[model samples]
Target: MKYAVIRFPGSNCDWDMYYVLRDQLKVEPIFVDYRETNLPIDVVAVIVPGGFSYGDYLRSGAIARFAPIMEDIKKFAEAGNPVLGVCNGFQILTEAHLLPGGLRKNQHLEFICQQQDLFVQNNQTTFSNQFKPGEKVMMPVAHGDGNYYCDDVTLQQLRTHNQIVLTYSKNPNGSVADIAGIVNEQGNVMGMMPHPERASELVLGGTDGLRLFQSVVTRQLQK
Candidate 1:
């Protein structure tokens, strides 16, 4: 299956995600420029990789949310196809209202970049099925706006629906409820502050993140 990697101006991690999916995961990677209005016909999954889009002008992803490609992504996601957004991509997903909640500046008001410990809160979802339930994994998080926040009612709804998929073992960004990643209510779309593409290879210090991509492949193969 083909995976579409959306590339906006200033997207540094787009190549990283492309490499992992194309080389390591053994899938076709189609780079979709932000200005494009359509995804490739064979694309089965969409990936919005992390980076400073539009130079992070108004807000992290505020401007990029209006990009033409996002409308196609929104429709793809609504069709129950898997969509994974990392860091700035996560911010974009929320800004576009594809995912609930929003990411704000880190509590300490500084950019953080490091290996982070994360617990898989739910492994049954499309993006995390390769992981064991409650598994602890390490992924790199690099961002200034990674603190996730939602109101009480939304938090409770996330809890009630098991939409919370990953949480920091030791909260680093002061995210509400220690949430590091979450899926949508339908569970096909996921957004996270961590950069799984950076951690997907052993040469990159760990292979924990490879399973996330593998999970998506496995899910597709089963269908």
Candidate 2:
């Protein structure tokens, strides 16, 4: 199967994501430029990797959200295809309204980069089926604006629908309810602050993130 990795002007981790999908997952990964208006027809999944897109101008993902390819992405997502967004990609998803809530400056107003432990709150979704509920996995988080915020009602809705998928073992960026990752109501799209690609190899410290990619591949194969 094929996956699309969207590359923006300042996307530094696109290759990292490509490595995970192409080498580790043994899947074809197509790099879709932000300027492109469509994804390859054969792609079964889309990955919006982490980076400082558009130099993070006007806010983390405010500018990148308007990239030409996002319209097609939105449509692809609406059709029940899987889309995974990490860090800056997560911010872009929220900006595009593909997901709810916004990422704000870290509570301490400083950039943070470290290994973080996250609890799997819901493993029934496509992005996390390899994990057991309440499992703790370690992944690296590097961001200056990773604090997630949403209104009270939204939080309640998220809880009600089991949309909150991951929570920090110890609140890292002061994200509400310790949210480290979340899925959309339809459960096909997921957004998270941690860099799973960075943790997918044993040399990188652990392989906790590998299962996430495996889960996606398994889901596709089953279909």
Candidate 3:
């Protein structure tokens, strides 16, 4: 299936995501600029790649969410189509209210760049269906505001509903409950603070991230 990788001016990982989909996964990825509001009809998935949009001014994704395309992204996600947001993309999703809670500054208040181990918490979602829950995989994370936080009530609901998709095997950014990723209740839209595209190739040190993309593409074909 075709995917659209949204591109804001500051987006750095757009090409990485594109290369993974096109060269590695053999799927077409259309690079849609931030000003565009309509998605290609052939696009079965959307990707908001990692980047410091607007120089991460005001806050990460606070400015990026105002891009003309985000409203459409939200609508596309609400229609139960797959949308994967990585790093700053995760910040955008939270800013746009596409997902719950917020990503605060790392508890240590520093930008962290490191490879981390994450356990699949829920494999039922389109993003992680290829793996079994509790499986550990390595992915790279780079962000200053990767610490996920929410009120106790919302946290309880997320846990009770099994919405948490991935968790740090060992907390790295001080994220709440070691959450590395999560999906909306509908299970279509997924957001993670880690850069899966960066880990999709063995040359990049690991190929574990590829399973997330393959899971969604395979599931769509099954439908």
Candidate 4:
């Protein structure tokens, strides 16, 4: 299976995610430029890395949604291919309608950059397969527009489907119900505000984030 990581003009974490998949996880990484109209035919999965795309001008991810490649990304996701969106990538997913809900400014209206404790909510999906439900893990998050919002009814549906993947242990961003990450109904698409790639190296802090990338490779092997 081939792994493709999207690269937008202002993407800064693209290389970090690329290294995580290539050097750390030992997977061949394909960087897909945002200008490209299509994903490689063999691409079996994708990672939309974090960064202030288009400088977050018209609002985070607002302009990126119109990129020609976004349409293909959505179609690829609908075909059940694994899709992981991190930070600004999460914003893009919401903007592109691949994931439900929107990410607004942090409750404090400040850019928060620090390690956050997260509790695993659901480990049944491809993205969380390596984790145990309710387990605590620490990952770094850096963003201003990280608060997640959605209607109460949609939130209830998310709960009913067990779609919530992770919850902030300390509610750092004031997201509803303290949600930190979530998966689509099909479980192939997931969006999280944390920078898992930043924590993939033990020397930096912990390798807890490595499993997330491994989860993708493991799931591919299962198929």
What is candidate 3's lDDT per residue for 94-187, written digit by digit as tens? Answer: 9999999988999899899999999999999899989987899999999999999988999999999899999999897788888999999888
The 0-to-1 C-alpha lDDT of every candidate, in the order given, reads: 0.95, 0.95, 0.91, 0.91
Ranking by lDDT: 2, 1, 4, 3
Residue runs of model 1 more than 4 Å from their true location after superposition = none
Clashes of 1: 0
User: Rank by TM-score, descending?
Assistant: 2, 1, 4, 3
> What is the lDDT for 129 in model 4?
89
Q: For candidate 1, what is the lDDT?
A: 0.95
lDDT of 1 at 122: 98
Predicted structure 2: lDDT: 0.95
Off by over 4 Å in 3: none
Clashes of 3: 0
Extract clashing residue pairs from model 3. Answer: none
> What TM-score number comes out for model 4?
0.99
Residue 103 C-alpha lDDT in model 1: 96
Positional deviation of residue 168's Cα in model 3 after best superposition, in angstroms: 0.5
CA lDDT for candidate 3: 0.91
Q: Indicate the TM-score of model 1.
A: 0.99
